[model samples]
Target: STNLSLSIDDKFIQSIREELTDLQRRLLTFSIYDKQTSIKDLSKESALFLWFQLFKDIIFQLPKSEESKYEMIEQCRQYYHGNQEELTNIEKFAQTYTEQDSIHWYTKQCFISRLCNKALRTQDIELLYIFRYYIQDLHKRLSLEHQSFRNTELNPPILTLYRGLKLTHDDITHFQSNIDSLVLMNGFFFTTRNYDLELESALKLSKHSVNILPTLLIIQVNVQLDHVIFAKISSQINNSNEDEILFDIDCAFKIHEVYFNNKKNVWIITMSLTNENRLIAGKYIETNKREIEQG
Candidate 1:
């Protein structure tokens, strides 16, 4: 492993050095050094002391005591071993996981630590996917639990950086206000099945005053329209074979899935509308799988 001598908690570092089973230690080390996944690459990249030194900067920030240190190491071990089990039923997992603050903290550290390691060693999109999966999962879970727009504090800082770097069209609207709907079509609903042109159309349309925006991600079919000042969001259907999930707009249109089962329907009815501001928000609800178009 690259020995960057990144500062970390001494006691916590010591526990990682001492308490972890040989296999667990090796797995942790490999996660940091190999820049990718697989038992073969892990074995090849595994380094004991060097890996510990590289994370020194971060580990040192935690409380330093024999007991506290061991506790944190055990937490790390639990995280590495627990994630597969945790993600099985995303809704169930998120509901249970977020209730416990420690799990949330552990989850946050686990990804950042892995990302930091990957940044120093590899150049592959797989790591990026790994990062994205975690983020999307977390976002969905958080939204489900809260059932409202995410507060500024809870938004993942890393995702903000990811958007800034990628410069995707959605990135532009992410920070903007007064925009209500965004549609991104990817398959079966795109014009020529090209998402790029469709995205361009939406971005261009952003110049107009659309109270509620739509982002479509279907293939070859991309479109945008201004919606009524007051609207509610729900999903007549809940599940999808793929990661994508659909939501309903007042039983009229299917939108994208933004939350998990733990949350109720994200129905944002027109609570109030004004010349300067239009607010559409609602309680979270569960959904099923079906398609309906309102006339």
Candidate 2:
């Protein structure tokens, strides 16, 4: 230890203590995010408890105005200043994006999808607030699309969708424990009506890593279901041949069954869109949204 002067003893000690505390916080945060860290998954109730609290702070924090929206886009523009292609896309988005094109921009391989998905999954309040302008528009667009989608006479009464993703043991266990419970999707859920492509993707991902389990989600949606919004958006975007369907952010679904398919060496979970759980969320969230819109 360095020798300290008597006059500086108390102040210097406090400063060093504060520095140590900050350093410790940084280390702990890093460890929490480390891939090797084994963190227990929060139960659905606990996670939703956190979500409602966080949503209260986040959903209302965004300043609604033309300038704030521009500033948000400029922040994204500055973020990708180093990348020429993204820079061009960002500029084009700023000049050309209409509310109807929200899904088109989102489905594109760009920063909007990456940033919004990450912020939504992590529930990063600051980023959520920052991107609120685009997010709101995207959800609005999806709702409009949903109306047209369900009314299409050719569409089936019950639509089945498939998603392929990699999950950890904790992720699988979380679903297992939450059977017959409501799950609020935190991000924009992407799936396709094509089974072969999804299965192939699941197989490829399953082989990529042993630490994560390959999972296939078989989601069934009833066109008559209310209080949830999703749409067949492949028509809205160019060059998308997967017959892609996208569910709006924060849509709620019921998990009916989860099982490991031993033959395929993958976990298959089945879910159905339900309005029963959304009735609870709707009561509170609708209140807040109405207040925000009225203001």
- Per TM-score, the best of the predicted structures is 2
lDDT of 2 by residue, 1-295 (tens): 4555654897888777654432221110000111121113444454453364347345646556788678778888877889997888888888887777888888774778767766776778788778888887887789888898888924579988987777778778878877776666667777888877777767766565687777788998898787778889888766656688888766666788999989887889898887654455444467668878999
Clash count for each candidate, listed in order shown: 49, 0
lDDT of 2 at 194: 89
Give candidate 2 misplaced runs (Cα > 4 Å): 1-64, 153-155, 282-295
* Lowest lDDT block of 10, candidate 2: 25-34
Q: Which parts of model 1 are misplaced by more than 4 Å?
A: 1-108, 111-113, 116-123, 130-132, 149-295
Q: After superposition, how far is residue 133 of candidate 2 from its true place, in Å?
A: 1.0
Winning candidate number (lDDT): 2
Error of 1 at 82 (Å): 18
lDDT of each: 0.26, 0.70
